[model samples]
Target chain A: MAPAVLIEKLQKRYGKVEAVKDVSFQVEPGEIFGLLGPNGAGKTTTIRCICTLATPDAGKIEVSSINAIANPKAARQKLGYVAQEVALDKVLTGRELLQLQAALYHIPGKFAKERIDKMISSLGLQEYADQKTGTYSGGIRKRLDLAAGLLHKPDVLVLDEPTVGLDIESRVVMWDILRQLRDAGTTVLLTSHYLEEVDALASSVAIIDKGVVIAAGTPSELKDRVGGDRITLRIREFCPLEEAEKAKDMLKSFPFVQEAIINVAQGNSLNLVVTPQSDALITIQQALQAAGLPTFGIAQSRPSLDDVYLAATGRTLMDAELAAAGSRDPKAERKQNMK
Target chain B: MSSTVTPSKPNVSLKPEAMQVSPAPGFFGELVQETLALTRRLFIQLQRRPSTLIAGVIQPLIWLVLFGALFQNAPKGLFGDTVNYGQFLAAGVIVFTAFSGALNAGLPVMFDREFGFLNRLLVAPLASRYSIVFASAIFIITLSAIQTSAIIAASAFLGAGWPDPLGLGLISLILLLLVLGVTALSLGLAFALPGHIELIAVIFVTNLPLLFASTALAPLSFMPRWLQMIATLNPLSYAIEPIRYLYLNSDWALNSVVMQAPWGAVTLGGALLVLLVLDVVAFFIIQPLLRRTFA
Candidate 1:
């Protein structure tokens, strides 16, 4: 069977700004694929192209073998999209909104009724079905929007930031629902800025930045490829820079240690990259103790997705997020979204 | 937060074969389904929040009673050979109400675009996106009818007398043509303008100027040469004059002169033809805009 969604060299530009530049990825059937990036990283733009909301300047998009760019209507039939912002008509009750969604997909009346009820119950929206969406909380509104997107039963369900504003409980519930969707053989493609969201749910992920894909793989494979277990140790909670540097220099000479750096932002904590071994942390502790450096705290864990991003971009995801937030022009972005 | 509320096999029933469970309903059937669905959404909104409709009806009735009374004491033949100023002003108010209401048809669409709800419709595999255009036209025309009926009833009560049944039917046709043409232009603006703020700005500057330029409040003969020329050229004047002719004349026909413009006499048939031309031209002007957005 063909890949559920294939986008090649996808390029989309709004005015002088290239929102998506050379993005390419493939999502196989029955797996949760994630496009992980910070804001303004072209994640939403790529999803728009797949959903037929915007035309890409240069690209080929295929949805289950249909050329999405050339034949969007057929592709649209096979794909379901839940937008980043839940665009519900607040005046409409949840049930009425679902009926409108059902009609748009040209679902048969009887089948649509059955499908809508199933979606409502599955999303746990039975009690809120008859109330106006304006009266719903953010969590309930999102669930209703999800039901609307799934009512047509598309082959691929594409969501952009599915849990951006939800509370922790709602976010976890959303994750559970998505896992169930994939288990039922629906190809799921989502974009999210939350590291944990993708790490916990996506079987495969592509990390994008500045409109380009820099890394793509399963989460564990990416962690393994980065080649180290991380050890964070602080000689003192607010260790002097010279003492932290001394600790880092001593830790670097160990046979199992791959790299060591002093993290000044974390009060001069020493971060070490080491080859996987049970005694690596003990060796570092022993070296610190022999050098008369006091140990305030110490912890060891496997490399995380953030480490992969840091390795590829040399900047942490949090740093990239803050930078993106400062530079984005609200007026220009709203104009692009309107069209 | 409990997992029990979450179904383990939520989409299990959503086998791909469910789509094949129903045969294709054919193109026209799909078109009607989507159009009616869209149109139904608008009606549901109107039903739940009736303020706009209530204001629409009341505003026109106020114009009929208050504006007519303001000019009540004018000499009987000063405006025309009509029995009263109310009679002469009745046609203007009817046409103006429809024109203003139709001019605002794009506001909802513009709001939808701004709020991102339009993306929901665009993402759907619609049979034809023109169904969006169709739904707006149908809703606006129906609204114009309701407003027109309310004004006509108020005018009759204020002693302006009713048009014949055939005259009522013709009045509906005239409003339909005017509403459709204005609605097309408004929707074009909704798509072309950047946001609802700009669209509303355009509507604000357009509404009163067009009313003044047309023969809505005054007759062509009463205006000076330049103003008369502008009023005769105004499409709203064509809509107003024919309905005024139907109201004041008991034995009217297609050939009966409705207005004596500065150029020449414009008969009832000629006026209707102008509205038809305006409709065709409006559609042509917005065709490219629609294609750009829809594509």
Candidate 2:
């Protein structure tokens, strides 16, 4: 079967700014595909092009095998998009907003009514359905928006930063709804900057940075390719930089430890990359003790998505986010996002 | 309670087969449905928070009562053959109210673009994105009708005799044409302006000046040569003078002379033709702007 969504060498530029340089990803039917990146990594721009909200400067987008650029209305029918900003008419009640959304997708009246009720209930928006959305809390607004997005049941649901401002409980709930949608055979493609959000929800992820897909694979596959077990050992809650460096130098002497560095940002904790071995943590602890250092906290685990990002790009995702944040102009970005 | 609860099985009701649920009703039917739905949202907003509508109606009513009172002591037949100043000001107030309200038609669209709500409408599979423009026009026209009715009733209550039933229908038609043209231009501005602040600034400066330039306040004869020329050229003058003629003359016809400009005479039918032309030009000018932002 053709992929539910196929974007090939997608290139979108806003004037001189290349928002999406060369993004290519395919989301298979019945799977959750994630586009993980920093804030300005072109994830939203790529989603916008796929959703027919903006035209790409170059490349192809197909929704359920239909050429999206050539047949936008047909492609729009096949894809449901929940934008990062929950754009609800605050004056309209939650139910009213959903009903309006249902009509927009051209759902049959009887079917729309039934499906709208199901969506409202499924998203736990029943009690708040009749109240104006302006009175709703942030989580309630997001839930109502989600219900509206899914009211017409499209083949693929594209979400841009779906959980950006939701509380922890609401975020977890959103993840479950996405999982359910996949189980029911709806291809889900989401763009998120939160590492854990992508890790927890996406079956496969493409990590993008500065408008390019730098890494792509299952979370474990990408982490395993990085090829090292991570050990985070803090000699003390606020270990001195000299003591952390001394411990790092001592840990580097072990045969199994491949690399060690003192992370100055985290109270000067020592991070060690080691060849996979059950006894590696003990050896590091012994080495630290021999150096007259105390192990305030320590953990040994396989590399995470952050490590995969670090392996692909020398900077961590958080650092890339900070860098992107500093360079972004709010006025220019708002203008870009308006259309 | 949590959306993330892993269900025992998938929602069988939402199976992939269900995803192929249906296409819209026929194309035109779908277009009308979406456009009407969007239009309904605007009406709902007006109903719930009626300050704009209330103010729109009251502002014109005040102009009719107060402005008429201000000119009460002027010499007889100084303005026209009308028995009082209220009759002449009635048409001006009606045309001016519709024009001002229509001029603001773009404010909501500009707000939608800024707030990202327009992105919601753009992403939907509407038959044509022009439905967005259509919804705004429909809403603004309906509002013009309401405001026109109130102004007509107030004029008659204030002793400005009612026009014939046929005259009222003509007034309605005239307001529709004027609203259609002005709404198009305003919606275009909504797309062309960078933000709401700039859009509002434009509306603020253009609103009262356009009213004053047209025949809404005084007859063209009361103005200097240049002012009469400007009033004759104003589209609002076409709408105002025709309705004014209908009020002053019960024996009205399409060929009845409505406005006598310094250059020549404009018949009722000719004034309407001008409004129609204005409508066509407004649509033509905004086509590229709407396509740029909406397409």
RMSD for each model, in Å, please? 2.1, 2.3
Candidate 1 has a TM-score of 0.96
User: Model 2, which residues run further than 4 Å from truth?
Assistant: B1-13, B17-24
Off by over 4 Å in 1: A238-242, B1-20
Which of the CAPRI classes, incorrect, acceptable, medium or high, describes model 1? Answer: medium
Q: Give the Cα error of residue A177 in candidate 2, in Å.
A: 1.4
Compared with the true structure, all predictions reach lDDT values of 0.89, 0.88
Please write out the lDDT profile of model 2 over residues B196-277, one tens digit for every residue: 9999899899889889999988888789999999999999999999998888788999999988999999999999999999
Clashing pairs in 2: A176-B4
Candidate 1 lDDT over residue span A171-264, tens digit each:
8778888988887789999999999999999999999999999999999999999988999998998999999888888787888888888888
